[model samples]
Target chain A: MINSIDLILVLILLAVLLSLGSSRMMALIKIMALQGAMVSLVPIFIEPQARLSNGGILFFQLMLLIKAVLIPGLLYMALNRIAIKREVEPLIGYHASLLVGLGLVMLSAYITRRMGLSLPGDYALLLITAITTTGGGLFLMMSRTKAITQVIGYLMLENGIYLVGTALTKHTHNIYLVEFGVLLDLLAGVMIMGIILHNINRAFDDVDTAYLEQLKD
Target chain B: MLEAVFCLPLFAGLIAFLLPVKLGRGVLVVGALLHLQLTLLAWLSDFPPLLPGYFSTAPAGILVLLVTSFIFVFIAPYSIFYMREQEMQSEPIFIGSMLLFLGTMSMAALAEHPIVFWIAIEATTLVSAPLIFVNRSKKALEATWKYVLICSVGIALALLGFFFITLSMDRAGIDVPLTFSSLNTAAKHLDPLWLKIGFIFVIIGFGTKMGLAPMHTWLPDAHSEAPSPASALLSGALLNCAFLGIFKVHTLMVLAGLGDFSGSLLIGFGLFSILVAGIFILKQPDYKRMLAYSSIENMGVIAFGVGIGGMALYGAMLHLIHHSLLKSSLFLSAGNLLLGFGSKIVAQCGGMTRLLPRTFVSFFAGFLGISGLPPFGVFVSELLILIGAFKAGHPVAGGLFIASLALVVAGFARIVTSMSFGPSRQEILVPEQTLRIVSPFALLLTSAVLCVWMPEPLHQIIINTIAVIGGTIHG
Candidate 1:
């Protein structure tokens, strides 16, 4: 039987795939929230020793709140205000993006296998999931035309990095304060991006970033 | 003392946000003066870090701190005049963000720990985003969006790199602190594979912020679209902070005996940046964008110098100082031109020598200084870098460096000469002001003076900074 950790990792990978295939902004935001919650859970499950500390528990709770609730809530609010229900005229088609997402997962798996890193059991899977999530986020950012989608992409990227941090770092080395700072930065980043998205909508009458081509060389 | 260096700005920024526009501008100037004074005091005498583990002033840190502080003291007053001419609706926010941006950059400069540095660098992006969008124009909005998204993504990767570094320590069973100094001392015992991987990520991440080639798409747009004073800070003070991040990691790579691996990457990115900038500079239409590309080229030079090691590293340090001075001056002068002609298109800015003689002198002088002309510190720095490149036995790289420099100079000459002598366009929108012109002039003068004479303390600091990478003045 697959362990709970492996199950959660697979669920997170599914979230990445769903985000890539989904065209609706609301769906993407929901997928990110789910992914964020899963990413926060990884630390607690992977490092049982970390759960012993009250500070770690409090830090994880804070991370969960921000990553899962605060950031996605901000993006959701942006989506409502902008009223752009879907990412229109994406630079790439959805079918092609889904195919690219599949290729990314396979490539990440190949990399993990070729590196021969002696990670603990199932960590190679964890690494593969994190890499795919990160790559998918970047692809989303590059492929989608809407500014809101790019913000979601950035949040996805941060979530992946958070996973990498959890998978690689030791429990004892994880300082709650530094992690808190990182989370705060991420929250603030998403909020700021949301504000800009609102302004872009106001200025251009839509959230699409194709209008931004005016500044090119 | 270190707390005061950043705290004064933070406190002033809050007040500036609440106050009236005129008072807010006053607070900004006062805060800049106080910040610069604190920076000088910190430089002259060492004090224990207020927060011992998180913050301290290393030689490299102080070098960047000095540049940031010095440039701000000029930019602050110029901004008052600049905002007044524009009559910005969000003057308060602009002033507040400027101060906050200064505070965050100071924090980055003084940060000793990798995570602290990461947070501080990321903070610079958040704080400066408002300054870019303060204009509320469509182009400003685009620039701000791209700036925030690209930089935040880049810095996120840097966080992963930091994790890998921690992983290296875990694998090696080394229990040292995560400070750069400590890490450097323990680097030899760390896992080399993980360390190399970490270095690559850090370089690419911070290199994106540093405007190195292939990752520099955001630089031209953000710099050209932001208000001139904000562009000056972004180009001058902010890029140096990103370089400090890379330089710190490179120090660790050197200590880990992987200097060759990291050095070649820097050299490769640096040369490509120069080539790219050279190619784009040749036919650039917008004057501000041209200067922005020039900033990219100078950054390339600094990176190349550092990567060459030995004497070139010393040259890189000097290039860092001179580039900050000259490029900020150029941006500020470009601001005056923008104000005078009410356009950023180079074609519309002809006969600048006659139209705005005061700005022309500073603008033309700034061009000469940036293009590595004599009587300027950049001349000395570029000469030193070239000599270092040859001394390091990279003759092909040296040749390419020279060729790129020639192309840049040729392109810059054509533009500056045309802007100076070509037929005039529309009438001046806002005539040049003494207050606006003073900042750029002072910066150019500083570069010229430093070229002729090097102060002992500053010279010693440069030596100490480069010594870690095996750099010396005597090639």
Candidate 2:
């Protein structure tokens, strides 16, 4: 039966496609923020009847805050700092990327069906969305030229992995602690990338990965 | 008490961030010494984990910890002298980041929980990024960018692998804690299919950080761009932390009766890395980049030996320790060369034999030692691995191993000869100092001494480390 969890998962998939096709950096950041919030809410929806303790409530809220507000906020600041607006001249054009995104959905669905792991409560849809988000993130990284976009892609990849972790493993006592640490690392990684983005802009007048090809062997 | 081995350096690093540059340098050295003392204490005595579930002193973890601590004791002091000659934008940040990097690596070594190990490793990448970019040059910025983005993504996959491992346990109806030690004990119950998938992802994830080829693109650039002492630590200590992650998982695989699958994969990556390093080292322009590729080669050697099992696993352990010592020494001596000639390009350097006599001795000796000459531990380790490979009935792979070693040595010799004996080209920029030269010599001497006389405790540790995987001392 259709439920709120599937709705959220479907929205996340749409956001992934939108991110792949969007030419503007600001729209991409917004898409990521929406995707992050939706992804963080999946665990709550999956286990709605298993009332969360105080610690679990606080952990989920913190996850939502970081995933939705902090990370995209950092990217937004980084975008403004670098002063780059539109993603110019992607390696793959927008239309092709959109088509590829659809292909990724089908691929993920097939794989999820092939390895049937008796998950509970619309988790098949969740796994498909997770795999598509991951593949989309990796594709974005390889196909985009801007460093900021690559960071966005990395965040998307991380969100997908987090979803996989949630859907696959049962919640243990220390799981929240580990997840919190991962969230903090995500925050710090974005901050460091922001600093490097500013430097890359100052040094080269652009944040394009094209200019970073000098030191290669 | 075991936690203090990492905690001491971390607190010191936080203080280094606030202190003045002069005092920060003092903190760096003192922190290193205290860390070494704590490491010795943990090694010599039984120091129980403060957090029993997440942190423990396993044999493999402690071995990596000891090697890291020993290398830091020398690299910390060498960094002080190395930094004195050149001005950095933020000296305090550099020193602070070095200590934080040490703390993260120590945490990775001693971590028993899978997720905790992943956290420690990811923290290392963040902390060490500052060390690479301390110079703030454009190339340094590029290198830092690659190092962070690549390692973060790579380690993210490792986290996914850990999740898969947890999933395997869940599928088996096991309710054990998620530490590696517990995972090993419960491994036989895990579904083999999921375990295999987890190992693939884990190896790719950790192997990338360990500088295994096909994922080692960031290594040469980051190592070459980082300041010398930072490069030394990256080569000597940081890579071992990543290898420890892979080694732990490989042991789990062996326990699960997946040794052949994991071993073949390790051998494949190992040989590929050696080939890649050999090809790149030939016609290499930068001396520092050459040393970085050499690190990739050594990592490959260690992976190969471990994959072969039996006597070769013991060789891998010896190689791990000796590689840390000799490679750090080489990088320090290369630092002296950079200080003397003011260039990293080999063609721009010449007549180090005449220009800097003391550095020349250490550099040439390091070259010989790294090339697997006698009076050094690499020679012994390489011989053991080769013999182990043949005995394991992998004659073709053994032959390729020897061929690649020859190619690497030939390329390495050409570069070393020209750089040391080529016609005099440039004037010395900074005169050699006793402090700058002593650490490298001391590091090299330690390797030689260990080769001649294997310490009882270290030997016992190696035995304990490989005993689970069916590795024996006698061929």
Candidate 3:
């Protein structure tokens, strides 16, 4: 039987896959929300003996709220207002993207095997998941044409980084205040992206970033 | 006191947002003055950080803070006239965001801890996005989108790099605070491998925001699309704050005895950015975009100088100061040209000397200063960098540096001559104003003055800033 941490990692991986394969904008947002929840939960389970303080607990809750609820809510609101039904034509096809996602996971696994660092138990899997998630997020950003979809890609990348921070660092260095600052910055960044998406939609009558090509040299 | 230097801007930004447009403009200028005063106090005194682990006024930080504050003082008043000329609808947002951008950049400058520094840099991207989007044009929207998305993604990688550094400490069992000072002291004991990996990501991450090439795709668009005053702040001040992040990490690498590795990386990125900017600047369409590319090239010069170390590191710091002054002045002048010609394309703008003679003077002088002509600080700085590069056994990089500089100057000369003398496309749309003309001239004059006579205090600060990397003015 898989442990709770392993189960969560699997779920997170599954969310990344779903995000890449899903064409519907709302479905991708849901995958991101799931990934956010799993990412925030990783710190709690991965360092069970660290004994989080009251402030640490509160920080995690705030992270959960922002990552899972507030950011996705903003994206959802943007989706409703802009009314873009789907990412109809990606720069890369869905099938090629899935293959790329698989290749990324395999590559991460290979990297983790060769690194030969003395990490805590199960950290190899954590590293692999983080790497795959990051690569997949970047791939999504490059392959998608829609502005909202690109934002989702960015969120995925951010979530992957959050996982790396959790897997690699010791809990002692995890100052609650600093972590909260990072969370707040992420929230503000997403909100700003959402606002820009609204403006992009209104100006061009579509959220497709293809229209943004007019600014080039 | 250091807190006041940043916090005052935050408070003023909020008040500016709430107040009417006219009063908001006053708040911006007042906030800039107060910020400059506070920065002077912070520079002169040794005020402990209110949040001890997070923020401090280090030598490098103070240099950047002084530049940011000084530029804002000029850009603030110039923005008043700019907004009036453009007849901007979101005047309050523009004013508020500019002040807030100042606050965030100041925080990035003052941040001591790695994660705190990352957060502050990321916050700078968020606060400054609206400034790029303030024009509400489709192009502005596109630029804002790229700025926010590219910078956010790049900085996330930086966050990952920060975690890697912490991992190095954890592996080595070093329990010191995560501030740059503490990290430097503990560098020798830390794990070198992870530290190297961390430095690479931090460079790439912060380098993107600093407008270094390969990751510099977002810069020209954002810089050219934003209003002139906002463009001035972005090109002049924001990029330096990002450089401070990379510089602090490079200091750690130096302390860890991995200076050669980090130095080579900087030199590589630096030279490549110069080459890219040089190629693009040739036959560039938009004058604002050309200035933006020039900003990239100057940043490349600084990085190249710092990487060469010894006297070149001193050149890098000098380049940072002079570039900020000259480039912002050029952008401000470009703003005036935009108002007069109603076009950003160089082909559409001609006979600038006859059309807007005062702006032409400032613009021409700014172009000279940025191109490293004599009597400008950039000339002295670039000369030192080349000399230091040769002395440091980087003769090949030094040669390439000169080639790139020549190419840039050649491209820029063609544009300047054509813009100043070529046939006019249309009548001037808006007459040049005294307030608009004064700021760019004043900024160029500041660069010229600093070139001829460096103040003792500022000279000392530059020495202190580069001393960690073995930078000395005298070979």
Candidate 4:
């Protein structure tokens, strides 16, 4: 089950995420699409064993389709609507974010190793991918300045959490519903927040949080 | 009927949405009264006992729900005058949202399921978001933004903490359900490592909602920017709802064999919040924000007491009750001052004692009660917390607690003396001519009575109830 295709998929995901944490907002969306592609393969890699029930396979495919493809498509539409161009300024510089993302990836691996998340004792790369994606998403959140960018960061974080649950298929079933609910909620959250971002830009002429100080005492 | 306590508010919220504006504000009071009535019924029943997981009301939440419901009852009428004075036409939306906000808070308190509790907590963030935006001011929008972003991020981390709690139970080979009963029953089997991580995340998440230090940046702005009645609910009841989450999780942490891990973290965050509030309040120029920061400090004291554990949890719960009354009164009075003097900055307006004697007196009383002066509820709560800290061998925290309280007291003293008792700036002062001016007086009186004497029967029940929840893990 340790397929070369799966390894290549994860490597591409990593390369894309490395781009997401950079100042290039357009590049961030491309990386998101690549990460999206890798997430769709997670179910196949986890259990190509016909040892699964029909219902399980159906749900798996549904998750892959909805999460990896449909959600990204919706976000792409939003990107076109808002037209926020590349991030003009970020709270933390993009280069520093890349370094921090690297450190978080390392931390995720360490934490996973401690928790024994590597299933089949052979899929060490799965553990690495889970941590890297989650860390990268968080890095996007911390470094990004644009409000839309923050929303995108949150979406990537959801992708990371999805991988965590997917890797743990051997342990539970109830978690699948929770993961779906989380994704739905996250996607809805991004869409609503995107609208709010548009309003902020329209009202203030800039979506940067720098001018959000109108409420202070 | 027990579940009805939460559902009734939801129903009221929906009905309010369909009503006329003038009728809507009036309907909000009706909803709040009904909510209080339902809370009393639940308090009298056995059906809604803490769920079968870790810790719930047989220990800590009964008192929380009762006190919160009781204060909401008083604040409901106060809100009527608040709305009427503003000539609010969109009352239905505000009232409906407020009902949902309170309903979700009760759900969080009475939740048997951990996931249910998280959902309820998240619901509060959504429902309260609209309430903060009730004024639709630029400032309101800004504050609402901070409130939503910070609290949502905080609650998300809390959810992650829930994930860790489940992960820990998995490690221990016990099928510990997320219910209070199940968690407590299986607590001994929980993995310590995962519990530590879970407790930290839960603390920070709920702590942000509670306005605990470092994560408390949203409290002052949101509290000061919202309408007074909303601020009353926020400072009085909402923070307690968040604290209930932390308290419940800590109960499980104790049973997980990582004794004091959660408690120490609470104490650390609590003490830091108090110190931060004290430092900032000493130089604060805005009185409303100062009061907001004072709230952060009081929440810190409660956290410290809860972290101390054992007897300290009881003290923490007691302080939770007293502080709610004191703070809501203070905020309501701030509203009166705002109405009378039309300014929030301390330097811009004053001579309140000469301008409006009744409001000035009530404001000072609230300030005194919050400062832990004798004969008030805060004084008694503080004493209990200090005793609990010493009992838990946290004498250093106890010492720092006294120093921080003194610093806060001094800062508040200067503000009260300067704002209420002395010179007025050039701002125009209007004469009080309506019932709205008198409503704050009434709220402060209820709080004053609670401080002076929390009826014996209620106190006995609440104290016993808290002990049961707090002791569930240890037993």
Candidate 5:
């Protein structure tokens, strides 16, 4: 029986593919926002045993706001600030990257079955989506030249890792506090990256990482 | 309380961000002094955790905490003088970020819970990013970007690794609280397959931050581009915090009877880092970048020492202490040279023996100390690790280790010699100041003193730290 949890995981996998194939920076950020909102909802649906205490509900709301709204909003502001509306010239082409994204799903499924952990219900789907999202995010980082897009890549990577954490660990531990800390770190990391991105734009007149090659040995 | 060690710096840092520039400088120094005092107090007596699940002091962590605090005490004062000479545009931010970086590192040292440790480690990366970009040059911007992006990605993998460990625990049907101490106690019961997988991720993740090669691409750029005082802290102190993360997980692997697998992996990465550092150091154009590569090499040596276990693990602990002291001192000396000549390129500025004699003395002494010569703690530690490698039946790795060390020394000597004595007569920009000169000398002296005679308590602490992994001082 397919449930809402499995549905959310599949949507996440689709978001990963869209992010990889999308050429415009603004569209990539939007995909990340949608992926973030969906990934944060997985924990609530997957664990039927975890009755939503007051704290848990509050935690989920905060996670939703930060992951869905606050982070993408910051990226949106950063994009406007840079005023670079041109298409990204990826090292790998959009079609090729989309193919790679599809490949990642197949590879992740192979790995999930090979591990043979016997996860209950559709949790295996959660694992596959998690791995594919992570791999796709990494691939995005390598293929893109612009720094802002790379940061978007990082956000995807982070969301994927969050899914992995939710899938593997039991919620019996008072994990809210720890998870909250991780979220805070992610928010701060994005802010810091935004500031640096602004500076990079100011200095080089573009966020192309190729301009950053001056310091290498 | 244990919490105060970190809390004091976090608050002081926030205050420093708002205070006047002069006042911020004072807070930087005063904050370091107070932090050292609290760390000493924590060392002398037990401070039970305010939050038992998140924060606690273990022997190894306290050792790292002490080293971090001791180095900051000197670097903070040195930064005031260094920044004044540079006429920094963002003095308050630099000062504030330094303090915050200290606080985050202290928190990482004290973190008992796995997630708390990850948060602290990740926070360190975020806070320290500003330190590298304080100069605001194009190169500095590039360095800061790479440092943030690479370390963040690497550390995120570490979070995944922690999840795997927790998964292992769930599979074993054990329900212990998620702390390193608790994990160590229940380690023998963990499924070896998951445990092994987790160890690989943790090492690679933390290893990236610790400046192991392949992942060490960011270290040289960031270190050389930062203001020298910030570079000193990044090289001397920050790397150790990352190493502590790997060390904790390695202890668990050993307890779970998977030492051989983890140890071999460590040895491989360690030797590779040394080889990589040696190749880059030989033709290195920038003096600061050369020092940064040397840092990578020393970190490799420490990793190799710990991986060989037995006496080598004991040597690794000693190496950790001396490397922080000696490498930081070297960076401070490099800072003085930068101020004197206003250039990072070695060929552009020369005759340091004539133009900047005081800096030449400390710089030359630092070169000797770091090269593992006599009267320096690194010498003793490296020797012990070498002997242990042979005794532990890793003679081939031992031979590769010595070859890499020789290559590193040869490259290092060429660079240092040219800088100190190579023929050039450029006018010095800023003459050596007493305040600028004292800290490096003091740090080098501490390393030298420890080499000859370690205090009894420090020796005992080193013994306690290594013993958890079956390391003994006497082979």
Candidate 6:
């Protein structure tokens, strides 16, 4: 019997799927936000003892607060400012992307189960988070037309990995430092990328990657 | 002072940033010199006291720090020339960012812990993005975008790999310290499943940064699009930083009794990288992009050689040095040509030799050096790798290596023939302040000369570092 709270994980999985299949760039960014929130909750659902580390509940919630809520919102605002409104027709199309994402998820499950793997904790939520992150990142790269979307996909991928980290590993100083570094770098990256993308759109009059083939042989 | 080498650059980056723009370049040069001296000092003396925090280095990072510092030294005069006539206020910021890139790489090499190394790797990606867009052009932005996207994904995966290593160590009841030495000692007892999982992520992660095939989509674009100084450092030094991380992981795998599995996987990617370069080079239309493809190929060769242990790992180490020297020179000369004649496309350009004599000579010298002409550093290193390949009883692999290399040579020859040999198509003036582009070319000549001249001091440095790396992994 599936517990009611597990619905959040299922819905996150659904959001990951929708992000993979969506053509609307704006909609995909929103889906990314939902995915982030879902992944952040993974720690509580998966890591038990960690649930009590110095108001650990709030601390664990911070991962979602930053990763899920903050990042995607930042991305959406970037997209809005850039005014790059269009359906993302990936070099590879949506139907094929859906097929690949589905295949990868199934493969992850099959591979993990067959490996006879078991962690110290419940890890079921953590496992699902990892697979979702990997699959979503792959999908984002293949499914998005804009460079911004691809970066957002990469962020989603990192968030998924962080979910695994916080959920499974002991809360060490080094881990926290790694987490902070990752977030700061990713944020700085987005800011730098936003400036560049704005410049690209202004210069080329079209941020479509087709125009980028000038340097290629 | 291993710790000092790391600490100084970080301080220097901030120092360089705080200095005036005109002084910014000089400050960078001083910081590099100080950093290099300290690294040399560390190598000569006993291990530097490990600062009780997250960062440190071993015998390995001393060599990494030295090589990167030398590259900075080489680029200094060149950057002085490279940045001339560049716009107003952004100059300081740009130079500051480049210093930060070096500082981050320094921390990475000097780090004792896995996470510090990962942060450094990711930070290099962020710092380098602006360098890609130095010209503020549409094309530069696209290249920068691709670079940011691909490498970000790759490094993120690597960070995940770091987490996996931590998890594996935890499973082994090893107290989960996450230091290189600690992990190395416990690696043999780690759960094979977790170790394998960690390795897959590391390979994919670092492999992207190393410009390995499949993950190499960003390399050629970023290389061709960035200014020459950035391209030279990108190919010469930056890729090496990523390769060092991968090398450390490979060493850990060797200790874990997973040497064969990891080696086999590396060889697979290495060969694929060469094949991709071969195909790309054959049809390549842009001369700069062609050089970029060649970098991918040379890196592929190193990866393949490293994967096939025995004499091969030593060969890969040697190849890494040679590739850095020759590739930097090649890209620098390419930069000279682009400035002299305003085009990277092979078909549009002609008679470059008559118009730009010194640039032509530099280009030819770089070409000869990179194409493995006898007496050039690349020739010696590549020949060693070929011999290593044959000794490993992989004649098929050897043959493939030879063929791929030949394909690059012939393709590049066609590019050079059209671009540098014919009659003067027009009067080509060198860019206003590009006189110092010759520095990288001069450095290349020096490196090539060392390969033949084999001075005792230099020989000691190269041979000892190779042995240090090889001794750890060779069964």
> What are the chain A TM-scores for all the models, listed individually?
0.96, 0.96, 0.96, 0.81, 0.96, 0.83
TM-score of chain B of 2: 0.99
The pairs that clash in candidate 3 are: none
Candidate 4 structure quality by residue, lDDT tens digits, A1-217? 5676467556645754466556665666666766766776666666665425545566666666766667666666666766457787777776776677677767767877887653654676676776677667767767766766776676676666556645543444344444455555555555546555665666676666667887543
- Please state the error at residue B156 of candidate 3 in Å: 1.2
Candidates in descending DockQ order? 5, 3, 1, 2, 6, 4
Candidate 5 on B150-188: residue-level lDDT in tens?
999999999889988988998898999999999999999
Instruction: List, for all models, the DockQ compared with the true complex.
Output: 0.83, 0.81, 0.89, 0.32, 0.91, 0.55
Task: State each model's CA lDDT, in order.
Answer: 0.90, 0.93, 0.91, 0.74, 0.92, 0.75
- Backbone clashes in model 6: 2
lDDT of 4 at B135: 78
Q: What is the lDDT of residue B187 in candidate 6?
A: 77
**Between 1 and 6, whose lDDT is larger?**
1
Model 1, position B469: C-alpha lDDT score: 73
Docking class of 5: high
> Quality of candidate 2's docking, in CAPRI categories?
high
- Tens digits of per-residue lDDT for model 2, B1-475: 7999999999999999999999999999999999999998898899998799989989999999999999899999999999999887799999999999999999999999999999999999999999999999999999999999999999999999988888889889999888999999998999888889999999999999999999999999999999999999999999999999999999999999999999999999999999999999988989999999999999999999999999989999999999999999999999999999999999899999888999999999999999999899999999999999999999999999999988889889999999999989657999899999999999999999999998899999899999988999796
Candidate 4 CA-lDDT value: 0.74
lDDT of 3 by residue, A1-217 (tens): 1388888998999888888898999999888888999899888887765736556777778888998999999999999998677999999998888888899999999998888767666577888899899988999999999999999988888888888887777777888888889889989998999899899989988999999987777
Question: Judged by DockQ cut-offs, is candidate 1 incorrect, acceptable, medium or high?
Answer: high
Candidate 6 off by > 4 Å: A1-8, A18-31, A44-65, A86-108, A166-174, A204-207, B1-20, B47-53, B85-89, B431-438, B453-475
TM-score (chain B only), all candidates: 0.99, 0.99, 0.99, 0.93, 0.99, 0.93
Model 1 misplaced regions, further than 4 Å: A120-122
Q: Could you tell me the lDDT of residue B367 within candidate 1?
A: 93
What residue runs in model 3 are displaced by over 4 Å at the alpha carbon?
none
Give the runs in model 5 whose Cα sits over 4 Å from its true position: A49-51
Error of 2 at B203 (Å): 1.0
lDDT ranking from best to worst? 2, 5, 3, 1, 6, 4
Model 4 agreement with the true structure over B394-471: per-residue lDDT tens digits: 789999999999999999999999997678655545555446545556656666677677787577765675564453
Question: In candidate 6, how many Å is residue B226 off?
Answer: 0.3
Instruction: List pairs with backbone clashes in candidate 1.
Output: none
